[model samples]
Target: MKFLPVGYNTQDLEKQAKNKWRWQWLSECDSKGMKWTDWLKKIDVCGVAYCTFCGKTINYKSNGKKALKLHCEDGNHQKIANVVKTNSVSSILAI
Candidate 1:
Protein backbone atom coordinates (compact mmCIF):
# COMPACT_ATOMS: atom_id res chain seq x y z
CA MET A 1 0.00 0.00 0.00
CA LYS A 2 2.35 2.65 -1.14
CA PHE A 3 1.26 6.25 -1.51
CA LEU A 4 2.59 9.36 -3.05
CA PRO A 5 4.01 12.06 -0.82
CA VAL A 6 1.60 14.41 0.88
CA GLY A 7 0.42 17.65 -0.75
CA TYR A 8 -0.10 15.90 -4.07
CA ASN A 9 -3.54 15.77 -5.67
CA THR A 10 -2.57 12.53 -7.32
CA GLN A 11 -2.37 10.89 -3.92
CA ASP A 12 -5.96 11.81 -3.18
CA LEU A 13 -7.07 10.44 -6.53
CA GLU A 14 -5.20 7.22 -5.88
CA LYS A 15 -6.83 6.85 -2.52
CA GLN A 16 -10.25 7.40 -4.03
CA ALA A 17 -9.57 4.74 -6.61
CA LYS A 18 -8.54 2.27 -3.98
CA ASN A 19 -11.65 3.04 -1.96
CA LYS A 20 -13.82 2.37 -4.99
CA TRP A 21 -12.17 -1.00 -5.52
CA ARG A 22 -12.62 -1.92 -1.89
CA TRP A 23 -16.26 -0.95 -1.98
CA GLN A 24 -16.82 -3.05 -5.06
CA TRP A 25 -15.22 -6.02 -3.41
CA LEU A 26 -17.42 -5.54 -0.39
CA SER A 27 -20.48 -5.45 -2.60
CA GLU A 28 -19.49 -8.74 -4.16
CA CYS A 29 -19.11 -10.26 -0.74
CA ASP A 30 -22.57 -9.04 0.20
CA SER A 31 -24.05 -10.66 -2.87
CA LYS A 32 -22.45 -13.90 -1.76
CA GLY A 33 -24.29 -13.74 1.60
CA MET A 34 -21.38 -12.25 3.48
CA LYS A 35 -22.22 -9.09 5.31
CA TRP A 36 -19.31 -6.76 5.86
CA THR A 37 -20.90 -5.06 8.83
CA ASP A 38 -21.55 -8.36 10.52
CA TRP A 39 -17.99 -9.46 10.01
CA LEU A 40 -16.68 -6.15 11.23
CA LYS A 41 -18.82 -6.27 14.32
CA LYS A 42 -17.54 -9.71 15.17
CA ILE A 43 -13.90 -8.64 15.06
CA ASP A 44 -14.08 -4.93 15.82
CA VAL A 45 -14.07 -5.03 19.58
CA CYS A 46 -13.05 -2.04 21.71
CA GLY A 47 -12.85 0.19 18.63
CA VAL A 48 -9.90 -1.75 17.23
CA ALA A 49 -10.31 -4.50 14.68
CA TYR A 50 -7.61 -7.09 14.15
CA CYS A 51 -7.15 -10.56 12.78
CA THR A 52 -7.61 -12.97 15.66
CA PHE A 53 -5.54 -15.61 13.89
CA CYS A 54 -2.72 -13.50 12.48
CA GLY A 55 -2.77 -10.44 14.76
CA LYS A 56 -2.79 -8.11 11.80
CA THR A 57 -4.45 -4.83 12.70
CA ILE A 58 -7.13 -4.11 10.10
CA ASN A 59 -7.38 -0.93 8.11
CA TYR A 60 -11.07 -1.04 7.43
CA LYS A 61 -11.29 2.35 5.79
CA SER A 62 -8.64 1.52 3.27
CA ASN A 63 -9.07 -2.20 2.67
CA GLY A 64 -12.58 -2.80 3.97
CA LYS A 65 -13.98 -6.34 4.09
CA LYS A 66 -11.53 -7.66 1.52
CA ALA A 67 -8.77 -7.68 4.09
CA LEU A 68 -10.90 -9.61 6.53
CA LYS A 69 -11.85 -12.18 3.91
CA LEU A 70 -8.26 -12.53 2.81
CA HIS A 71 -7.09 -13.10 6.34
CA CYS A 72 -9.82 -15.64 6.89
CA GLU A 73 -8.69 -17.55 3.81
CA ASP A 74 -4.97 -17.38 4.55
CA GLY A 75 -3.31 -20.66 5.50
CA ASN A 76 -1.48 -19.10 8.42
CA HIS A 77 -4.67 -17.57 9.67
CA GLN A 78 -6.50 -20.88 9.43
CA LYS A 79 -3.71 -22.63 11.31
CA ILE A 80 -3.68 -20.01 14.00
CA ALA A 81 -7.45 -19.97 14.25
CA ASN A 82 -7.43 -23.69 14.77
CA VAL A 83 -4.70 -23.45 17.38
CA VAL A 84 -6.60 -20.79 19.25
CA LYS A 85 -9.76 -22.85 19.13
CA THR A 86 -7.91 -25.87 20.47
CA ASN A 87 -6.29 -23.84 23.22
CA SER A 88 -9.62 -22.46 24.32
CA VAL A 89 -11.12 -25.91 24.52
CA SER A 90 -8.11 -27.23 26.39
CA SER A 91 -8.34 -24.40 28.90
CA ILE A 92 -11.99 -25.15 29.47
CA LEU A 93 -11.24 -28.80 30.01
CA ALA A 94 -8.47 -27.91 32.42
CA ILE A 95 -10.85 -25.73 34.36
Candidate 2:
Protein backbone atom coordinates (compact mmCIF):
# COMPACT_ATOMS: atom_id res chain seq x y z
CA MET A 1 0.00 0.00 0.00
CA LYS A 2 1.99 2.87 -1.35
CA PHE A 3 0.34 6.04 -0.09
CA LEU A 4 1.22 8.79 -2.53
CA PRO A 5 2.06 12.25 -1.33
CA VAL A 6 3.31 10.22 1.58
CA GLY A 7 6.32 10.94 3.69
CA TYR A 8 8.22 8.56 5.93
CA ASN A 9 7.89 10.50 9.16
CA THR A 10 8.24 10.12 12.90
CA GLN A 11 5.38 10.40 15.39
CA ASP A 12 5.72 14.10 16.11
CA LEU A 13 5.44 15.30 12.52
CA GLU A 14 2.17 15.15 10.56
CA LYS A 15 1.31 15.66 6.91
CA GLN A 16 0.07 19.16 6.32
CA ALA A 17 -2.10 18.17 3.39
CA LYS A 18 -3.38 15.02 1.81
CA ASN A 19 -1.73 13.69 -1.33
CA LYS A 20 -3.61 11.80 -4.03
CA TRP A 21 -3.02 8.21 -2.98
CA ARG A 22 -3.41 8.93 0.70
CA TRP A 23 -6.76 10.51 -0.05
CA GLN A 24 -7.78 7.49 -2.06
CA TRP A 25 -6.79 5.20 0.75
CA LEU A 26 -8.84 7.26 3.18
CA SER A 27 -11.86 7.05 0.90
CA GLU A 28 -11.39 3.30 0.54
CA CYS A 29 -11.26 2.93 4.28
CA ASP A 30 -14.37 5.05 4.57
CA SER A 31 -16.24 2.90 2.04
CA LYS A 32 -15.38 -0.25 3.95
CA GLY A 33 -16.65 1.21 7.27
CA MET A 34 -13.27 0.82 8.90
CA LYS A 35 -12.52 2.80 12.02
CA TRP A 36 -9.64 5.23 11.57
CA THR A 37 -7.20 4.09 14.24
CA ASP A 38 -4.10 3.15 12.25
CA TRP A 39 -4.81 5.38 9.27
CA LEU A 40 -4.81 8.71 11.09
CA LYS A 41 -3.12 10.30 14.08
CA LYS A 42 -4.12 12.61 16.89
CA ILE A 43 -3.07 16.21 16.38
CA ASP A 44 -3.15 19.15 18.73
CA VAL A 45 -3.42 22.87 18.18
CA CYS A 46 -0.71 23.25 20.87
CA GLY A 47 -1.24 25.60 23.79
CA VAL A 48 -4.00 27.54 22.10
CA ALA A 49 -5.75 28.81 25.21
CA TYR A 50 -7.19 32.04 23.84
CA CYS A 51 -10.15 32.03 21.53
CA THR A 52 -9.77 33.74 18.17
CA PHE A 53 -13.15 35.48 18.29
CA CYS A 54 -13.73 37.38 21.53
CA GLY A 55 -10.25 37.71 23.02
CA LYS A 56 -10.78 35.78 26.26
CA THR A 57 -10.10 32.43 27.88
CA ILE A 58 -12.97 29.95 28.17
CA ASN A 59 -11.07 27.77 30.61
CA TYR A 60 -11.13 24.68 28.47
CA LYS A 61 -10.08 21.50 30.22
CA SER A 62 -10.32 18.41 28.09
CA ASN A 63 -10.12 14.78 29.25
CA GLY A 64 -8.20 14.16 26.06
CA LYS A 65 -7.02 16.71 23.54
CA LYS A 66 -10.11 17.82 21.63
CA ALA A 67 -10.51 19.65 18.37
CA LEU A 68 -11.97 23.13 18.44
CA LYS A 69 -14.45 24.74 16.08
CA LEU A 70 -14.54 28.51 16.02
CA HIS A 71 -17.49 30.76 15.37
CA CYS A 72 -17.17 34.36 14.25
CA GLU A 73 -19.25 37.43 14.83
CA ASP A 74 -21.10 39.64 12.30
CA GLY A 75 -19.55 41.28 9.21
CA ASN A 76 -18.09 44.23 11.08
CA HIS A 77 -17.05 43.10 14.51
CA GLN A 78 -14.11 43.18 16.89
CA LYS A 79 -10.86 41.85 15.49
CA ILE A 80 -9.80 40.56 18.87
CA ALA A 81 -9.80 36.82 19.67
CA ASN A 82 -11.87 35.69 22.64
CA VAL A 83 -12.27 32.29 24.27
CA VAL A 84 -15.31 32.38 26.53
CA LYS A 85 -16.84 29.17 27.80
CA THR A 86 -20.61 29.15 27.67
CA ASN A 87 -23.12 26.88 29.43
CA SER A 88 -23.91 24.82 26.32
CA VAL A 89 -20.56 23.08 26.08
CA SER A 90 -20.40 19.35 26.88
CA SER A 91 -17.63 16.85 27.60
CA ILE A 92 -17.46 14.80 24.39
CA LEU A 93 -17.00 16.47 21.02
CA ALA A 94 -18.72 14.93 18.01
CA ILE A 95 -15.65 14.47 15.83
CA lDDT scores, all candidates in order:
0.44, 0.26
Per-residue alpha-carbon lDDT of model 1 for 1-95, expressed as tens digits? 33222232333333533332222332333333433432332221211244434646555445655566765666775665556556877868898
Per-residue lDDT tens digits for candidate 2, residues 42-66, read 2232222233234333222331122
Question: Model 1: runs farther than 4 Å from truth?
Answer: 1-48, 93-95
Q: List the residue pairs that clash in candidate 2.
A: 52-81, 53-82, 54-82, 55-81, 55-82, 56-82, 56-83
Per-model TM-score on C-alpha atoms: 0.42, 0.18
Candidate 2 accuracy as TM-score: 0.18
